[model samples]
Target: MSVPAADRGATTVAERAVRRIAERAATEALPPGEVLAARGAAAVRGRRARVSVAVTLPYPTVLDDAGERVRSHVADRTAGLTGLVVPSARVRVRALRVREPKQGAEAAAPVARAGRGRSGAGRPWSQRRVPAAVSAFGCAAVCGAFLYDVVRVHAVGRPPARWRARLMEWLVTHGPDSGVWPGLVSAGAVFLLGVWLLVLALTPGRRRLLPMAAPAEGVRAVLDRRAVSALLRDAVAEVPGITRVRVRVGRRGARVRARLGFGGLESARRAVTEACEEALGACGLARPSRLRARVRTDPLWRAPTPPGANTGSGPAGSPASPSPTPDATTATTATTATTATTATTQGSSRA
Candidate 1:
């Protein structure tokens, strides 16, 4: 026997409703693979319907609460879209995804531009100034000491100490006989030191800031290297199986170091590399940079605890307890007062 056209249409509607519900459930805050493993079905009897869904989360999720949220959202969306009244939804977490290291690179040129304000161009003054001042002071002190020794010799008209006379006589005899190698090496060392000091004094002591594409015609955008590094670190850390992330943002390239917790190292490397690349693209740097990702497996790895999550006693996935509710009598009294005030204001406005 052939099915009625009305019955066939109803079946098609139910199937679409199930698919839409499953799609919505998988997309919220969860990664791509987690949702792809999800399956959902809907059955309609008269105007009422039931939704059944199963999903596999990549990480440990509070099974009870997460399931409840997904079930509720699915039912609501299905009911609204289809004209069916969804009474209940059944949701189950089939499996937890294995944490594997993922690595990828983003292609973006980092902005390389001069920084404004106090520290600009080169190394900071705090690092270079102290060393330069100390060198200058030491050179002046040595020169002063040598001048005093010469003046003392002229005034005394004879050697102040016999050792000084011996040293001078030794220098006078051996200095000519000594090879030029010793003198050349000493002179070269001194010249290099002087050049270093000069460079330190002249160069700016600031980190290079990465440039970004200008937002407007007359405006310029720049991001600090430290900020870029922090952004990449956080992005890489979000990938599944990654325990720790370290990022170094330079003018020409970015280096990402990721530590894995479990699963295949190759998968983890690919995931992490892709994540880093996405983050770099989002950063919107003007100059494209090479991305170098290194993934290392850490057998003893432990994921960092999120802030505000209790480690001591509460059930997994349960949020902290809310504050106590206000007294019913107080709430009623406040509502009454507000209503009366609004009534009086309306009466006065009419007058």
Candidate 2:
């Protein structure tokens, strides 16, 4: 079927209007929404049009509420700009932003300040002022202490403060403990702390959010490993006989560690592995990961007690009852009598 030029133009206009609306809604800074990608399509039938939009939000949002908001904005904008009655407006959230720890002031300050123009006014003075103040205070304290110590030592020809003298003495005498083991342990701890801090300072922690192959051109999507792990965990846990599950989602595959309670271990393992694979398949990940299931028998697991059963009692009040007659005493007496009879028979034979 061939479409008329006028109809094609109208559809283009409608799609463009919807796209603009989505960009505006997603870029708004007030509610902290950032649309990493957006797409829109419009269908024009005579005087009526239908618009559909899909957006990837690079942050966590209430999907239902955000979708509704986008739909409303797209419908209104499309109708106003294209002069077509929009009968349907649909919005889908393609991906959620990976949750990451907030970057320190050093990294976030520039980003926050650069967007001031688009954000209307800059953030309140309080937000920008605290970090600067803290830095200034630290510098001032260091310089002031240095000056005080220099003045006390040279200008006034006086001893340093008692605390300062004590600190110096401790550093000179006790700072390096005499024991080699203690020194090694201290050095190792300090080295590890420095390495940890260096890593944190040099690396952007949010890089763990792996980018997924986009379903559409000009669009990008990322999935959080932690979120995927949670999804797999829930799925594996639903399988019968799986009492607990832990899932670690990685770039290549997902590792599932499950505890089986009172069931065939092999069967439980197979069930959980199948369940996890199915769940990951449904997740629509760009690269489907292999499922590695490890099932362990929970030694402490016990069957659920029946409603009215008394678990505290044994079959009898006592676990075991002894015979009333003392068998050990009777046996000892018989042995003693036998020995006496043997001795008497020996004496008779001798006589």
Best by TM-score: 1
| Candidate 2 structure, TM-score to reference | 0.36
Q: Write the per-residue lDDT of candidate 2 for residues 152-248, one digit (tens) a residue.
A: 8899898777867886675555555655565567677878967865665555355446455443334456677888888888888788888888877
lDDT of model 2 at position 157:
97
Query: What lDDT tens digits, residue by residue, belong to model 1 across residues 6-84?
Result: 7776434656556666557545535555444365776767787777777766554676776666677767777777767
Tell me the lDDT of candidate 2.
0.67
Query: Weakest 10 consecutive residues, lDDT, candidate 2?
Result: 117-126
For all candidates, the clash counts are 30, 0
Clashing pairs in 2: none
**All predictions: root-mean-square deviation over Cα?**
32.4, 18.3
